[model samples]
Target: MNHEVIGGIPVLWADAPGPLEAVLMFGCGVQDETLRTLGTTHMVEHLAMSTLPRLHHEHNASVDLLTTQFTCTGRPEQVVAFLAAVCEALTALPLERIEQEAGVLAAEDGRVADPATAELLSHRYGVQGLGLAAYRGPGADRIPVEAVQEAVDRFFHRGNAVLVLTGPPPADLRLPLPDGERPDRSAALPVLRTGPSWREEDVPGPGLALHGDLDDPALQLACKLLSQRLRDTVRHRHGLSYDVGGDAVLAGPGHGERTLCLDAREGQEQRVAELLWEEALRLARECPTEDELAEEIAELREVYQDPRSTTCELGEAAGALLFGGTYQDPQTRLAVLEKVTPDEVRQAFAAALETVLLVVPCGTEVDPKLPDGRPLPRRACGTEGELPPGAKVFRPPLVDRLRSSDARRARLAVDGRGLWAREPDGTVHHVPFTEVVGVEMRGPGRVVFGRDTCVIPVVPELWAGIGPAVDAVDAAVPGQLRYPASAFRPAD
Candidate 1:
């Protein structure tokens, strides 16, 4: 690989056997935005791409959890034109086109990660940072102009970008981005739970998330081995599942989550969930055979040695430079992996299992127990059994209470510090006013979201005389954090 500086941006390139491919990557993505501005990065990406005229080259732009990339494959001149246009667009995005592109984005309705992996990230990091994957925040049309400008200013500048190419840059290549500093992303996102627990969610199958060091070769092989085992046992042997996959997400320099997900056959949700957990436990308890380790290593070697993977490796190196991570070349990584033994893999996986978060399909009955005979507790938003002291309480209306037993048990409470709700099952959820991330103003009601993933509804249908609760929320939360409900969303 060769490195050069072009127009204030660091450019990394290497020789390849095809048309030149270039990727303009920025360090910002969904993780940089708050709940109120969840789609701001995506909006920025679309707005920039919308400025490009129709060309004959294959080109696209995408925003994931941690990085945004604008890529194209064409001759050197075409690649140069694409990168220049993208950089120019970022410097002065067409604000007038936001509305049109908002509709386009809504139509796209894309997700950066699968449902199970998204939920697992949410369970670990609440509703901020990497956890934002599980939430579809305010609608695209509702994303304010200021948020878009802020994201561009903070992340789209030359200091926060890197250029990766499959071949040498053309003499005409230019990256005329604005100057700025790279945002500090060295600190890991706060973890909400480091658990060996499980929960039911609206997913197609069962998934598992284990928190660990992203650079650990043993843990990486462990995840690969577990997926292979599930593919053999769940898909081939019993035909209970059709697909089994896994991913490793980078949260920081050394910390991240490794996920394993499987899609089950019909009427096999519970069985699939059991098999997923059983295999994970078994792997943790016992060492993998040398053949299994060899198989995984061989597969990885194949991937790294492929000639088409030059751009992919360059992209990885760019990510490491942007995020303060140490980048390892494919050969170095393979050499390290080849040295790992079955016992090391087992030990790494066993330690990770202690922080595992499992997700099964909703309505599936599961009582996952740890290897020590302890039941993995179910996860919920609130832990308090009752409301706090000195809270102004509102109960369901008399008509509704008389109609159903559950209505009588439900209640809403508001204090000077925060808002709280007690569910029909007696679980209490509290969202402190200071930590309120976003408030969705639904007609006459409000949906209050907290940084800790707790949502409190200050709506009228659930409780009688909610005027005081609504007033408390409006007055407590800052005007900037509140927005009227999106027009595209369904009415409450």
Candidate 2:
């Protein structure tokens, strides 16, 4: 089987294989958000699959504008069929009708929320353009569903595709046409990343959630290190948090750079902020112990060194190949991983001295100190123990008070949908597709999708007396999810 292909396209066939797993990935780099809004790349992906005339395929794809990448991963037999379909769909989606898919494209193009996500992201990216919220990391993270759907319509085009294929093709697969080529691209690739800086906001909580932004090339590696150290020093060493975790958030759809994200229990916001700064200083000045250093290096090596032993991994490799042309070959990845050293990691850590945004959300009632050593203000509760007018409330998901280490259970009836669950605290999980997983029900008749199962949870209703949005991401796993409501409505 061949691993390298000219023009970032390849074919592999093996004679000894019994049932080879075939993978094909396609990628296109995106440079601007306007193209993302145009929906050219998305239409191409959707239509490509439609053209697969004979094969049943399963794949994953995302339209990333930050790096201008559109990736498709699927089987070899279907891929050839896919490309053909895309070529046809570009001119075929009936662009002439404003009544057709064109409107969908327009709707998606209009869905942009210029919010703190970007402001916070900018802190990590520093001056680098990678932090633009319109183009990075699941561009739909906080977007409306209608807008995300529309972005899909405008991306069906010719210029935004990077065809990548890997593994041995099944013998029955055939390629009949002479290879057609897309135009070659130019140099001047913008290096991705942000220099560190701080962005902060307060959340209603007894504890502060400190999240650091990444603008460093070595951010992915830095995240693994800092999170472990911070956990040991702030959360573990002193037992401040109930739980804590740190992860590197990649910004682009294909090969975007990384940012560090983390959450910890509340109460020591001021102390935690100081610890964060001190830890950054410590990482830059004090070298890690040899044992601590070697362990992290080994972990990095495993990400690529692990053999492709399953269809899932192959599918993942295929996705990376198709979407990020930069990572088209498994061997190259393995080779790169094998060559990493400890000194390189230390060097990356030392260089990340610039302070990034430190967002800490502490419950206002906690009397926690801010980084500058100021007391937190009391967050207000709109109303207690109340339901919206004309809404029926089934009891049990809520508890007035409970001793720590206690359990409670209840069933809720909203617009005829029954949601049952247990809560360690008064927090609720935003279940997908219920009139009200927490409150509204996509019910028999919701504001939209009357009976549709795409229930959007009432965005953080009341848990105890504090608005739940403040504790949205950090709560007990919801044992129940209902397919109900489609929009956010405040609890009256």
> Candidate 1 lDDT, tens digit per residue, 416-480?
99988888888889889998999999878899999888888888778889898899999999999
Evaluated at residue 383, the lDDT of candidate 1 is 74
lDDT per residue for candidate 2 within 1-492, as digits (tens), equals 334443234443333322334333333423323211233444334433444455456444444433232233455456555544544544444323323333344345432212333334433432233333323221222223343334333333322232333344444443222233333333222432233333244432111112332323244455567767877877778765443444333344433333333344555655665666566556655555667755666775565454543343444444444333343344554445345455655566654433234444432212333334444332221112222234233332244324323323322223323222223344332232332212223222222111112222322232232233213312322322212332222322
RMSD in order of candidates = 1.2, 14.2
TM-score of each: 0.98, 0.47
Candidate 2 lDDT (Cα, 0 to 1)? 0.38
In terms of lDDT, the best-performing candidate is 1
How high is the lDDT of residue 86 in model 1? 97
lDDT of 1 at 102: 90
TM-score of candidate 1 on Cα atoms, chains taken together: 0.98
